[model samples]
Target: MLVLLPPSETKAPGGDGDPLDLAALSWPELTDVRAGLVEALVELAGDLPAARAALGLSPTQDDEVARNAELLGAPTMPALARYTGVLYDALDVRSLTRAQRARADRRLAVGSALFGVVRATDRIPAYRLSAGSALPGRPTLRALWRPTLGPLLAAVDELVVDLRSSAYAALAPVPGAVTLDVLCERPDGTRVVVSHSNKAHKGRVARLLATTTGEPGDVVRLRALLRRAGFHVEHPGGTALTLVVPADWATR
Candidate 1:
């Protein structure tokens, strides 16, 4: 089973690993595109104003642009450790056992704007780029990624659980991939889509899937697995699973 996660806007800076190496990444087919994007980012970084505007960053976020400037030479860290936010915080990767860590390295992959997709253990440097960012002379990220990334993900044989946000998911959609939705159940019996804490829930789900001994081969089994793991999972038909959390719990 493969679980596709969205990349976080905030990343942990500084790493002990060597500098970026495109060839060492999992999908060698993406090496050219990755190199091109990295070069584009480096060039863009030279023009701080343009880079800030293109990346939707504020004046104070110039450090983020600096990170992009050093993309090629910056130290690297595993993709899982490089990403930080509510999602990664909830995943709590540091607490996992060796066996569970190995499983996570094998089953988890992150959707990246610059690298396309990387395995959990793939060593990557700190860089700032969002799915919606439009570099000066490059095609829209969706246009650049879909043609290649779409086919690659579609060709994967294992069951894919896609937990990417709409923006990243639009870059390269996985056909027949099972998706998840987080809902908050109010006391009035009405359910509202979770927004603020959605990632945390997905992170927990990913953690459960990563550490479990079972591999769900399809949406049905996936739903069963989540349900067995104590999640309030609902299959409202189709390939999407809805996980309902109490309104009070969601607010926290």
Candidate 2:
């Protein structure tokens, strides 16, 4: 789905490899995602069945959040509903009538676009860190790098801008990349890291490595190397990537 054949201008001067799979989602899928969001919003707003009736949704709307989250791989439908409710309240979304959710959904849609879930599978052997503790920095932050970094980084940066610095990662198409750039939140020093991944596959690939961490305000070197790796990487719009960091990871 990511690659839908090359773009119109492959040999042309401005041509950048094939177009990514950022096409408009199928209507049904969009509807499913939207419906899930609406239901979650209504439920969070108060009244469950009334929200469903108001939205013209079916009983299944009750399960839509979980269902949609599972399909979209988002946190959870209820979680989304809860977060979205928060966004709505913050932005005064509840009072906005029909015209508003339509407009606001655009931003949510962009958040969806920013995510590249396929990349998760690539980190099967990734280092796991607890929620409270730091994700490792500096010396311990040199393990996450992949060849796909060249093709995926820029998109991710754009996504970070859209998601406002929310959590994001990329898994190479082939998962054969030599390194990884993990975004973590440490207490004392660094906030993100770029290290060598695929160590378990070392016997098969031989380019085993470690990791590196840095501040969101300064990851240009890492971004450039990832681009060189053939990944269409982009530094997240400062606001976007920074916005996504967890409470502990955020500027403290």
Candidate 3:
């Protein structure tokens, strides 16, 4: 089976002299890193039609055809993310071309800055529900994506997770609606805005924060293994320790 990998720069890149280098890097640089993602996607799956569907696209996916057409010649984040969305669309699978996978890996290894969004619209409930990172001072933005595809999209959940970065990138379509918007605002302000803007339907999101009940060693090993198997795993913040395995590793 073909195992997909994420982009490498997802983790906050560190240079001897430039800790903020990752932040200052231009969109083109991010695009280069995104290209590597397509390379990995190609290695794992050769069928474009299949890949497109898995990323949550339909046979009538004419809209993305030209948008990502340039990707055929060069690997880039837009091309790869667009392609990944197509694959997830068709396959009913959550596939990250390179950037998302890489970012997920980083959050798993080293600690990461994440923003949380809630379900609501206009003068909504507070979104900084304890786990939210305070914003306004620190401006970290992340792309939001649906972790599952297919009829799953019908379930309706968006902004399942928000990754914190220097610049905000456009996110994939909302699981059911288009709530994830891209802008660089302070962290707290961003969360508040997202929380207040989008509406939510309960019981749709994956339990990434499920708590770990197993021994730390066992949990760590399982998490590492899941990552090695090429998945963007999530933790359900509990003692039970859940692993959201990628479709490719479902049998293994």
Each candidate: how many clashes? Answer: 0, 48, 44
Q: What ordering of candidates by TM-score runs from best to worst? A: 1, 2, 3
- TM-score preference between candidates 1 and 3, better one: 1
Error of 1 at 45 (Å): 0.4
Top TM-score prediction, candidate number: 1
lDDT of 3 by residue, 215-244 (tens): 213334544544554533444443222323
Give the per-residue lDDT digits (tens) of candidate 1, residues 1-252. Answer: 999999999999999999999999998988888898999999999999999999999999999999999998999999999999988888889999999999999999999999999999999999999999999988999998988889999999999999999999999999899999999999999988867669889999999989899988999999998998899999988898899999897854
Task: Summarize candidate 2's per-residue lDDT along 161-184 as a digit string, tens digits.
Answer: 121111222221222211232344
In order, the Cα lDDT scores of the candidates are 0.94, 0.26, 0.25
TM-score of each: 0.98, 0.22, 0.21
Model 2 per-residue lDDT at 197: 17
Which regions of candidate 1 deviate over 4 angstroms? none
